[model samples]
Target: MTASTSHRETTTADGRLSRYPVFLRVWASQSAGAVADQLLPVAFALYAVQRGAGAGTIAVILAGRAIALVVCLLAGGILADRVSRPRILFTADVLRAATVLGALLTLNRLPLAALGIVTALSGAAEAMSRPAMRSLIPALLPTGLLERGNALVAAVQRSATLIGALVGAAIVAAIGIRAAMGLASLLFATGAVAVLGVRDSVAGARTRTGVLADAAAGVKAIRRRPWVVAVMTAVAIQLFAGTAPTMTLLPLVATEQLGGELGYGLVLAALATGALPAIALASRWRPRRPGVVGMLALSSYAALPASLALALPLPVTAICFVIGGFAVELYFVYWLSALQRQIPAEVLGKTLALDQLSAFALLPLGYALAGPAIAAFGVQPTLLAAAGLTAAASVAALLVPGVATFSDPVGTKSDPAGG
Candidate 1:
């Protein structure tokens, strides 16, 4: 399915995004911080290799981070809804900066176990901030401008990460890996300072609801829109099928069947390049039934792994990946906008947190299964299975009551809390 055949006004009368100096300040701050965040894997990998640690050690460090992120996400959301989101963001970044500094100072001297713990701490700090970041925008702008706000945010995040990866490479090349980490910390500190401009009011006033009750309400709110569950289920299953297999098997396939590291890099670059247009597309595109359009767009992602299983030529596979990339962004941006528009502002933070946890909590299982599956069935079969699982999950979303039928200007759907 294609995007809707029309455009929406992307900004409002009192202010465009650029007119909001505080938003601009937060944007620049978060952009620089995001770049530093992109440097983390490189810094960790380089340090481990230099210190005679193996891939297994690096994996353990990464696993620590991922585990912490999943565990902390719900709590972060609860806190964001209950208190000040900007302060939470500021605190999270500050904590991340400190953790990076500690890791930098003790890199060579720190024990492997200690390093893993520190990495997990950094991840936890990041988890604490994300729900606040995601939910803050509804308070910053009227509902009408959400798509545009998301578009600008997406642009900044993607562009910063791309630039940050390159800059990280340069930093690692010129100085030591430790220096790159120091730079990451400095960038995070800058982000923390930038968020200071956002007053406590950027998040709506804290409701009188109790924390646990509010969290329950978030879940109840999600339940009211059965399609939300369908969307989350589809996305989670897709991630479970896509992430581990792609990370583990795709590199091997590139080496065995395609051009090796160069081919692998090219395919990844294709995905990134294709996704860049989504920012512009999402800003103005207004579909009559965004939920249905989003599901169909997401289903296109299954084609990528299917192509890999076919042992297609590098060019063919890259083309498939590009299609998947483009479709995936359309799905993400539209789904996010839909959630913001449909879900209540008071519960948005908790709902976002719950959404994140559901999507990521199963990733470890995917990793654990990928290698064994490859061992038993071989690369072609493993990739085919991933594709099949992704396809099944996405198609399953269509069976849910409202996913295929929900229309735009989803009026009553917006206030399911009955507030």
Candidate 2:
């Protein structure tokens, strides 16, 4: 059967994802997994502190995981296309659980090198799960509901992240790091069980290409699509220039200008709070030119850097953060939903991986550069530059041929679901 036909068959006639048992299972699995994913890192960091590791040691352990995730994401994408995505999800959760369990047992007794290896394993498992989780959505939901489904997924993930981080810290503070790690392991195992109920569907026709060729093919697919390249470029610029500097400077701003940790926490809470309404709106709104609208929305993030650069009052800066958060959620919901529909199923996993890779690969470099840039040029100049570049990239991306509507000029109107 065609991919479209398969999607329709799996979904209910009303196109409500909630009515589909398999989709519910997939959703449950993701919620559990998302919480576990957030919880583990926090717990690990706290555990390291409890074991008397210094900031440098903690940073190294965390960096190992982040580096491993970047290095392994492509392989995860390739495997998702070839293997059963549900199985990949299941395996990833199990592996994560094992890694957390390992940390729980050896965190104090083991050397830092051993802890780093454990974190790396957790990161690799996280990388494997991501592409599979996203690609599997198309298999469960109909075309008409893909946007809504994506919105729900985003909402769950964002909420889980906030909840997981708070809960992880709380648990660690209350009962110590071991209890937190134990809970994280249980959450991962629970996610694994939840995913077992999801129906397995192959994402694409099997390919016999060698691994290197498979990776190259994902690249070629992007080069063939001008819109994909444009959007990826825009997103990469947003993460690198806009997000990195904002993150680096926000803490300093909070300490010097605002109260302190409380102000920083409040600002972050506002950012996340703003996303809730945007997520709800995304579930219902279908803009005619999603690409154009989404890109414009993405430009709203400039408010955040501008707020920090001006050292706006705590309340005002927090409001700008709320706007930034709203813009990001709205933009990504449209962007990802459009991509799921536009890209051919055979290469969807790889394409999504490339999208993520482009956005994330520059982040570490951006973070590293942010402090140095601020040190040299001052925070105001550096932050304003980031804001300007973010806006410029978003506007420029619109000039690309397919980006205005996120579709080929020759065929976009023919799409029955519109943008």
Candidate 3:
């Protein structure tokens, strides 16, 4: 069958994928890849602890990974725009597998510095794969299916994260850290195989240009599009403010108010669980003003830190997390859909990379401030400050004239100005 015919047959009459075989393959790859990605931090943390490394050493290793990610992600995006995404993904997976194998074999034998370098290299490979995989999605399915497709992928990622952590913990507890690394390698290899199964027909046409030029063109595109810039800026602010509380202080709140590590896991899982239903229902209901809906969804962030500080019952806290997850997922569907509609297929990868960079640029700063802020002001006050910042961000986005009212449905052509 022709590519279009096969895709049509797999989807419903509305161009929604009722049973997209290719999507299943793609999802499988993503799940395996996600498992491997999630395994890394857990494994690395355990390995560091076992090595008698201090918290400072662990921080340095993790920081190295983040720095490598920022450096490699843009190059990965440029490569994806200029070459086959599947090929890039496959290569990244192979590299990751090699890195993990090397880590497993040498972690016990090598110096701490050498192990840190290998871990950073693995993180770079994984970072390279992400933008390419994200850019590949618009080509795999029709425009009408993008929201559902994204939702499915997000759900798989969430599930894989939860499962991978448990599996990694079990492997470490049972076999050893080396065994956990071996499992990660196997997962990456499986993901590579799945990427090989994805047909080349879904790959976007390549742009003819050097890397710098291609990246520049992507920047120019964003510069010309006011709404894209605005949305990206808003997302960046939201992410920065939310990161401190979500990643750092939430654990403290759990430990101090709820219980401890167990409570932290429960809350995290609750957030993921909340997102599940949102993903399931995303495509079924189309928002008339997607941008506005997305902005409104940011309000949910206000609930999380405040609720935690109040020492709400465990059930109530979990429910709040569920609500927060649902809101975040809903907003994400709209945000990604907007990008798919606004950005051209040829440069989508670069644009997406830039978007990611913008959104996460402040994460390091947030992480840095979290500990000191909690130590100085205490968890409750710090959390309340985060909530206030998050709320202000939402309000700011809502007040932006075009952001709160823009909408572009699937298959509908959007005005370049994003009206």
Give the per-residue lDDT of model 3 (tens digit) for 153-201. Answer: 8888767666665566566656777888888899988898887857646
Off by over 4 Å in 1: 1-15, 42-61, 109-119, 168-176, 202-204, 249-269, 303-318, 405-415
Model 2 stretches with alpha carbons more than 4 Å out: 1-13, 40-66, 109-120, 169-179, 203-205, 249-263, 411-419
* Pairs in steric clash, model 2: none
lDDT of 1 at 82: 85
Predictions: Cα RMSD each: 5.1, 4.3, 4.8
TM-score of each: 0.84, 0.84, 0.83
Name every residue pair that clashes in candidate 3: none
lDDT of each: 0.72, 0.77, 0.70
Which 10 consecutive residues of model 2 have the lowest summed lDDT?
410-419
TM-score: the better of candidates 1 and 3: 1
| lDDT, model 3, position 369 | 64
lDDT tens digits, residue span 1-419, model 2: 34553564455447577676787788888788788776666656655555666444555555556566678888888887788888898999999998888778876687864666777788889889888888878777777888788998999887776667667766765787778778888989999998885656654556566887778777877777778899899988988898878765665576678775446556765676677788899899888888888899889889989999998999999899888878889888888887787666667777788788787777656766776787799889999999999889998999998887887677433222211
Predicted candidate 1 versus true structure: per-residue lDDT over 1-419, tens digit per residue: 10111111232435377666665665666776777776775455445544666434555655566677789998998998888888988998999999989888877778764666876888898789888887877666666777888777777776665556556655665677777888899989988988886775634546677777877888887877778888788888887787657654554566567774446556655665566687679788888777677787788888788888898999998888778877777777777777776666667788888888888787656766666777788777888888888877887888877776442234534344523
